[model samples]
Target: MFSICLIGVIPLGTIVYILFLFFDNPSYQTAIHIFARKKCEQRANKNAPYIASYLSCFLYEVIKKNDIVDIPVSDTSINYSGYAIRKNSVIYRFITPVADMPDVDEYNLQKILQNTVIGQLNHYGITGLSSVYQDTTTIVPSVYIDRILYSEEKHLVAVDVLYICTSKDLLYYQNAVRESNNKNKAERTVYDDEV
Candidate 1:
């Protein structure tokens, strides 16, 4: 009798788990990803900054692993940041502060930036990437927002970079900067309409 009950419960549990994985709150996924990465990194390395960088890298890997975006090769002829695809119809041109730094010998910086971008994109539910192009010659120490566009529309949406010094702090900074910019844009639109 006990064995029969256990078998029945197992199937029910499996179904529930699958449902949660598919239909659970989307924000929960981000929180879970961030928390798990933070805990793992904290355990492996006590250095806060390094842990943060690692978290960024881990997040980038997650995005790539999940097939969220494609990384494009650099073209010397084009004098701008890198390009990426979204929704199979949108292309994004992005530039980062470290894109043009000769001093940036660290191989992991690119990965960190990729993850930061992925996290932001996922938060916005933007998917289907064509390619990612990168440029490292920007003036900002942590800027990424040169331009983004829907290929069909050919219009720029926002200009800002999601800056993250520590993995634990990435979400906070992203939200703050993004929200501020959005608010400013709204005000600008209102002012323009008045004019």
Candidate 2:
């Protein structure tokens, strides 16, 4: 009897999980739309490295125009993967995988940005700008652009770029990071820097 009950519950649990995946939260969907426009851009036909450099420069301009401190650094790789600094400490990184997600469309990408990063930061009252790279495989393609908010102290201290991953996976990874950060906060006490 117990074994039969367990088997029945397994199917019921799976149904619930599937429903949650399909029925996304509305705020998250809206946020992705808001950021989508600025996140997709076309890349130039130069070598991958050159294209990457161009993106960094483009992102720098956006950051600077928004009054974010720019930390200059040498060029790294290209093709949707690179990093930049702000005020010498905060770092932002971007990456695109060789392959795309199975179910993701333009709409999904837009939703991810709006709901996940931009919406969350806006809630915290941090504002800044963003640039998007599209079809980086080709030179001279459409790029997405937008403005975002990043606080001096709380914005993107560090980021690890990922490619070809689902938006859900990315959010789950971020949630884990948030949880870890929360745990760390309790382990340390405040200290005066002057001493």
Candidate 3:
């Protein structure tokens, strides 16, 4: 089973604290590595703040063993992040992050990112992404006069989150168990498995 401790935040600190049960730390070293490997240093540096999100799409182990290419056209050149895609599906003996799997689709992510999501699922055959600090957390259908529009809303975008965890990352615990029993039964199971 994957330990939540592996759920790291920003990969900046020299000291590592492992929260075996659950961790909300953020780390994009893996993404950064991929960025450098693909010679995307310029883009990565230009968008340093969103590096974690731009490159956050891929899991570390997946890109390490397989070939990854930065399909820049695959991303929205606007306000969010997108990363490289794995050449082939490489399964490891060790436990991988649940969020890395394409099956755990999110609800309120950005439309641009959502387009990338479908692309990742179809082309890359993998899916593990997180909202950058700028992405939306909730979609407000309508707000009262006192309330603000989704675009005008003041969401607390994390500046130095360590890239630890996204809003729905905790669902990993349930998503993991659900993926195990279903054997690809994820959403296709019941109307929706309670996981």
Candidate 4:
């Protein structure tokens, strides 16, 4: 009798679970959407390095009206409000107020800018490219979007993206020199030194 009752309960539980899975469940839908967005971000990150080299080559001409003359470098921390523009092999960094997020079309434009920066760095013969999304906020920029495809339930926020481009060869050579001399390993830091 106990075994039969247990079997009956298992089927009932399975049936309920199936119903929840198949039915329109808001919580489940939200979870799925969040998971998908994360996965997409991960895939983008993985492909970033491979494309950075190609993108950096065209960054200067791609980013329009860049007149800044120096690369913004921070010895202590990353700069969030500034953008780095590459002209030929020289990179100019300038600090400005936050730029607004582009609309869906502008988002495409942003992708072009991103690809351009990555490619320009690669053209400099730098390797090991990485980009990180540091912050997302709902503060809208001055730019306008021409069309809206789908409305988001939550206000869409602009993201702060940080890109790192460095040379593995130079790093390895420096490390080897330090090791041969039996000196303490130098602390690795990102410095946007003037080119």
Candidate 5:
């Protein structure tokens, strides 16, 4: 009777958990994507200053690995510092700072950041993006805004960022997953042998 309950309950619980994740993950992912796109669109239309944070959240939700870092704009200009997608042409690099660059150009920067967001969405299989292209007159929505605040003690400027993708990045991620599985298998083998 004990064995029967253990066997029946364990598998049932595992199946339920798997099913929960399978059903819930897509909805959560879609919600984040929609939120990111909508927030970016609103930022573009209203010149809002929340794109970086929103994009960071979106990247974190989709990637499930990398932690998107917000680069201090004052440190660099012209360097791609938004959602580091790839680095070393192999491993993912979310953001790298650009230094001592020209003065921030809000309009052009907004266009570049918007394209970066759209490009990332496309990479993740969200295709045929229309929000950025809805109004031809606007070209692309702004994903970054220039906002400066001074408190007589410190000054701050919010700069836009860029995202890039390469085949090597994808390969690296696949390899990493394979390696992780191999490691887990090795550990399980050791445990079974000890038992």
Candidate 6:
């Protein structure tokens, strides 16, 4: 009897979840969208490291133009946001570059930026599905994707990268370094041994 009940339960649960998205409230819809996208977010987190090295240089060119030069270091915690697109009835996944989640304990600049892309992709949907890369975009090299997935493909759409606001002992260290550089840049007149 229990086995017979289980078969109907799975489809019933899926129907209820889908109906929730049919709500009139926009915020409620978005919340369910996010909840559904959790696994995709985790997968994006896994691939952040592999993509970081390739993405860093390109990102910096745009990043510096909008703000005073901000150099990304090795590892940093960041976020993602974007839209999910669909073409026809098929949706392709932007799965992780690995079979398992990678440890992202180390914080760095590139990783943070990469994460923003990943997060953007995940936050936007359960899986990234777009025709952007297929639509006459220039082919770029991604050796990691080729090696792992056995093919090179991308569905990239540009998304903004944001840095996390941080407050810690590190702020003091960075501030000190900035002040020293500013002093060096100023025209210095030597005087006042005691005064």
Task: Compute each candidate's TM-score over C-alphas.
Answer: 0.20, 0.24, 0.18, 0.26, 0.23, 0.21
**Cα misplacement distance, residue 162 of candidate 1 (Å):** 11
lDDT of each: 0.39, 0.37, 0.29, 0.36, 0.39, 0.34
* Backbone N/Cα/C clashes per model: 16, 28, 16, 10, 5, 9
Note each model's CA RMSD in angstroms.
18.4, 19.3, 21.4, 19.5, 23.0, 19.5
lDDT of 4 by residue, 48-155 (tens): 434433333223233432223121222312222222222211122222222332344434444444454444444442233222212242221111111112224332
> In candidate 1, residue 146 scores what lDDT?
25
Alpha carbon lDDT at 113, candidate 1: 43
Model 6 scores a TM of 0.21
Which regions of candidate 6 fall more than 4 Å away from where they truly are? 1-28, 53-138, 141-195
Candidate 3, which ten residues in sequence have the lowest lDDT sum?
Answer: 140-149
Q: Model 2: per-residue lDDT, tens digit, 64-162?
A: 333222322223311244433222211235432222232333333333443443333334322222222223342211122222222344322122322
- What residue pairs are clashing in model 5? 76-98, 83-94, 84-93, 84-94, 84-95
Error of 4 at 107 (Å): 15
Q: Give candidate 5 regions above 4 Å deviation.
A: 1-55, 59-87, 90-164, 189-195
Question: Candidate 4, residue 32: CA error in Å?
Answer: 1.2
Specify the highest-TM-score model's number: 4
- Tens digits of per-residue lDDT, candidate 5, 2-68, equal 9999999999999999878875898887987889876755443342123344444443333232223
Consecutive 10-residue window with the lowest summed lDDT within model 2: 138-147
Which parts of model 4 have CA positions greater than 4 angstroms off? 1-9, 12-23, 61-195
RMSD of 3: 21.4
